[model samples]
Target: MTRRTLMAAGSMGLALVAAPRALARRADSHRERVEDLIARMTLQEKAGQLTLFNDPFRWRPGNVNPGDFDTDQEKTAQQIRDGHVGALFNGIGAEQARYAQRLALEESRLGIPMLFAADIIHGLRTTFPVPLGEAASWDLDLAERTARAAAAEGGASGIHQTYAPMVDVARDQRWGRVVEGAGEDVLLNKLFAAARTRGFQGDDLADPLSLLATPKHFAAYGAAEAGLDYNTTDMSEQTLRGVHLPPFQSAFEAGALCTMSAFNDLNGVPTSGNHWLLTEVLRDEWGFTGFVVSDYTSERELIAHGFAEDDRDAARIALTAGVDMSMQSGIYLAHIPDLVESGDVAMEVLDRAVRRVLMTKAALGLFDNPYRGADPEVERRVVGSPAHRDLAREAGRKSVVLLKNENKLLPLPKAGKRIALIGPFGADRSNVFGPWSIFADREMGVTFEEGFRAALTDASLLTVVKGSDVEAPLDGGIEAAVAAARDADVVVLAVGESHNMSAEAQSRVNIVLPAPQQALAEAVAAVGKPVVVLLKTGRALELSGAVKDAGAIMVTWFLGSEEGAAAADVIFGDHAPIGRLPISFSHYSGQQPYYYSRKATGRPELPEESEYKARFRETSNTALYPFGHGLGYAPVSYGEIVLGSETLPWDGELTASVSVTNTGDRPVDEVVQLYVRDRVASLTQPERLLKAFQRVTLAPGETVEAAFTLTRQDLLFIGRDMAPTVEPGWFDLWLAPNAQGGPHTQFRLVR
Candidate 1:
């Protein structure tokens, strides 16, 4: 097993170019050039192509690195020059990126171009709402637009790839990374995954404004036990296929060129070393041609998982198991070359990994011009540009979920009113970008006070008070808040978890309003004035006390750079709150691992009979705010669930329609959700599974019929045999607002 073996294997695709104009006509195809380059590479160079290193001095908080390690800049530079580092993360600016890339292309032996990657989860310079918040918008187009804006900023900054659109279906609120993904619905996860993927890569990877989207963490990282990060995940094959794997499949289908393996093990096998996941499912079944990169040091962590003997074993297990690239660990660089030569790892494996890297760089148009968009001027012009910020503001506006607006307390008057804005987040400039926004400048973000002042007319008066810290009470803060509430005609209480509280390694045992904030809320509510609770949070929190009883409540999940502006837009009635709960909000932390889709049990709790019927004595089993739950300024009503036919042929489709009318004076945008339940099947099915949804707008007193056509594919589920199959059976359907309850109908799937 050697370079000769690779060259011989790919000889048919290679064409020789003479020296006369070798530079101009070196190759006609990427395959030819990549194969030729592989042929000329040493084992170390091939291993280097599989290694991804971090920028030592440029590391920032919130960046994804599993372990703390020391680095020497000069040593790393020499490694890049010696072809021992293939890619770099931490996202150096355009100027620095150009310098490092020049070192690799001009100084390295093979002159291979290196890739630059960052975790652009939501946005780059112009930060947008976190992915979980954005999912609440239920606007695929907006999701795509935000991702496009992120790609534009990142590409201009010389970032060739982004580890983003975390498609994992996060079900547990305690999982800090839950804020990084779309909620528990498989359909929404798939839709958003596809949308963000397309947005990141656009239609052409060669486009300078496009970025390579890496959908991760591959396969059930979200299902970690106890909602803990990097914890073991064990599940039945059916659950794995049915619940966790579809979004990754959707992202790959949407043209994601790269993927990162999860840190956690799946059913006892680490994903970074899971042959069944990376090879059998991803490559052989789904036909994902992109290379698989291990999550930061995940390859090395295999040893800690007891799945490998040492670093060498970790390298062998991961690479042979189909992990193409190793991030940060340097385990691949340390052991891959030796493993390849020792007959422990095949030469074809090494060549395949190197080839994938080369092909990706080729797709990014790096070989044609390694300095793709590596211009300081371009970076300055595109990063945090006015257009990108406007898109962010629009995204922020859409991400707001009006959880409780009793008696229509929201859409407050914008003129001739005294308003009081209180709480820690009121005028705070920091923590607005949420997690994974390492590049955002906090100073540029808009605060709640700023937004309120800007939104108010000249005749209106605005007062601000920092009622309390996030987790502790401020001295006389509650009194000041109460005083401000008494003085103003309306009160806006802003509070919740800071950016750090809901991000990686920041999981909490209990998700509730801090005691001090709750006290502040209570004090403000006691003032007996109209109150609006601006809930700035990431995950679905367990609500209690005054915060829960506030007249109006909005989940404004850390709306990025324009957080203030967007909040103001919704608060002042310039824009309606359009976000719905992507994940369900439980009444208590005791209800762990909650989701809308659940299988029926023999001892199910009945609505009327709660005694000894698998019911909790202290609380109901339903979510406080169910999935897809949200309210707008205007009132909307659903007419009825209408089906075109009582029966659906196995090979044909069925149509379901619901007439939605805006009854209130203002316009209403409604998300018409279509859910289906297989009444009887070989394997137990969820009570209801979301199959389709549409967002429609209706003017005052206007009605619109929202229709969804379902094919056999929509009914297909993993059956007893562990294969996707649609069984002939009666199915219950719901045309609803949310997952809990809606207008229902039934249809038989006739075989």
Candidate 2:
């Protein structure tokens, strides 16, 4: 179904508007129970249901430090017992969650079970590659499996909900939060959103292993001004609808139980209090019935944004704007009751928010079993299990992008060859789990040295040297690295940003290798040994000098616990590098917010054009490594694009097909991407828009036909009136390996 169809057909809350009789009846039953509870609740209790608190004593299994305790633990605990807090976050451990749930159930007047939430961005314990890196694999099933595994582990630890699968369409490599999302393409973001939602919630939310999936930072958090986090975003409504809103819509359609409001302001309004975004679009348009929760202190930040007068005004505005819950902010608890009593905020509005929260808890089966899925035994068996580790290894292996392979120098021999593994990250374990990995254990991780030792029969053949710190010089480090490189037959230089460098609040202006690391790379390359640059990063960094000029370059973007083994697998040819770049890698840092789907300019940059054209003097207009670009052991070739017909009926469909062949001797996986562009439209369209993609495995000398079905729905775009429209016109199509150059054809949409 098209997005419009989904928007119209979807229902609010846990059940469809047009659900089956049995489902409708159950939903009615849940609503009745919630209504009864709400009617008995005092204004303070109703407000409390919309307030979420952080567990001060974040108790873990057998690991509790008194110094790390929240000094306000007594106050928070009393508030919970007094029915002033309905949810808790930042605490893991089945027993701890059970204790908190018992306090709410047994002590509170209403006896409502408390909800538990956490930032399960990638994984709970068995850390997977960062979400951006996972997107590089272009494997929807892999994304789903990793999410499912995380849900199981998190569920076992009594986490009722996970703020995950950040579906923001990020184009700015400098933005630290890009590491948490799929890259710039809306199509990829949409697919991954649905996959992760399905994986986390499974077929039923009541399932013991299922987690309430929250597709978060709702609407355009990625388009921050100058690529800075929490900055204002001023764009035309059409751009918002076309670029930013699609993924959130897609996630809602995929049955995400909840969503978190973004921190940034859209246009002139803060997203926390933007009624159009939170109510009109999310509810009336998309029919997201699940509750909307504010980001950490975002509701209170409305004052900082100058959108609200005070804490009371912030609480009133957020609730009226359709935000059902306040996270890590006491504003709601402090003023919501007074606002309701004084007729500033309606009782109906307050009740509606409370009802939504209650319904969500009911959907998680918390009403039936307060301690559901919080089993200490299950937690012990599941989190960081061997099975999960194996999945992480597979995910990491597929996420490794082979950026350059000069003369096919990779697939190094496993034995006899002397290998020098140089750089700070060669054996570093502190930064493998990229970002938002609160529960990740560095001790569980395998280092590059350990992976090499496990792979090689003669461990003496490999030498590891820390050439430099991530951003500082090490004493005599470069000299030792050079000596090792000279003595070895091959050198694997691992270098990139630490885990802390590419996450929230860590945006950088100079997005390249540190000066010391660059110097180390140049010195090591001067040794004249064949070098493979094993780059570990969270976001795309501009490449230059000897590191970029290395014989082989592999981008391993902060692969998690099994990163080392995964890298060893790719280096030893056990697994071919099948990952593609989800985002563009630019030649210079000046190209902030660069993407493949940019609208065509009046004066386009062309090789044969004059210097006055849209060309940059410092660097090339194109990316160093374009989106969807990657290399494998075996190269794949694409044939001419074949269309079903030159003209397609306005209401009819057509097929775009291409024959892709594995031309080399080895088997390989190839991602065949399909893109489209309208020749003319009411508004200017992007030069090319990614529509469909497929990952196909081809054996040596084997050819396979990859096909995509195209309909008017596929051509739909937000038009002049800010609604989805498809105008009859000629559309260009490309069936290629990546977003850049491909075999092209055209089809006309005729009335």
- In order of appearance, the predictions have TM-scores of 0.95, 0.96
lDDT of 2 at 440: 81
Per-residue C-alpha lDDT of model 1 across residues 111-144, encoded as one tens digit per residue: 9988998888888778999999999998888999
Error of 2 at 573 (Å): 0.7
* lDDT (C-alpha, whole model) for all candidates: 0.85, 0.85
- The 10 consecutive residues of candidate 2 with the worst lDDT sum are 7-16
Q: What TM-score number comes out for model 1?
A: 0.95
- Pairs that clash in candidate 2: 13-289
The digit string of per-residue lDDT tens for model 2 on 1-751 reads: 3333322221112222321233234445688888899989988888888988777655542222213434487788788889999998767888777778888888888889999988787888889999999999988889999999999988998888998879888888888889999999887887788788878888777777888888889879999888898888888988887877777766766677699999999988999999999998778876777899998889999999999999999999999999999987779999998898899998889988998889888777787778886789988998889999999999999999998999889888888899999999988888778877878876888888888888887989999999899999999999999999989999999999998889888788989998999999999999899999999888889999899899999999988889899989998999999999999998888988799999878888887875777767887678998899999998889999999999888888787899999999988999888888898998999889888777789999999998777777778888777777878999999988888888999999998
Off by over 4 Å in 2: 1-27, 60-71
643: Cα error in model 2, Å: 1.7
The superposed Cα distance between candidate 1 and the true structure at residue 697, in angstroms, equals 1.2
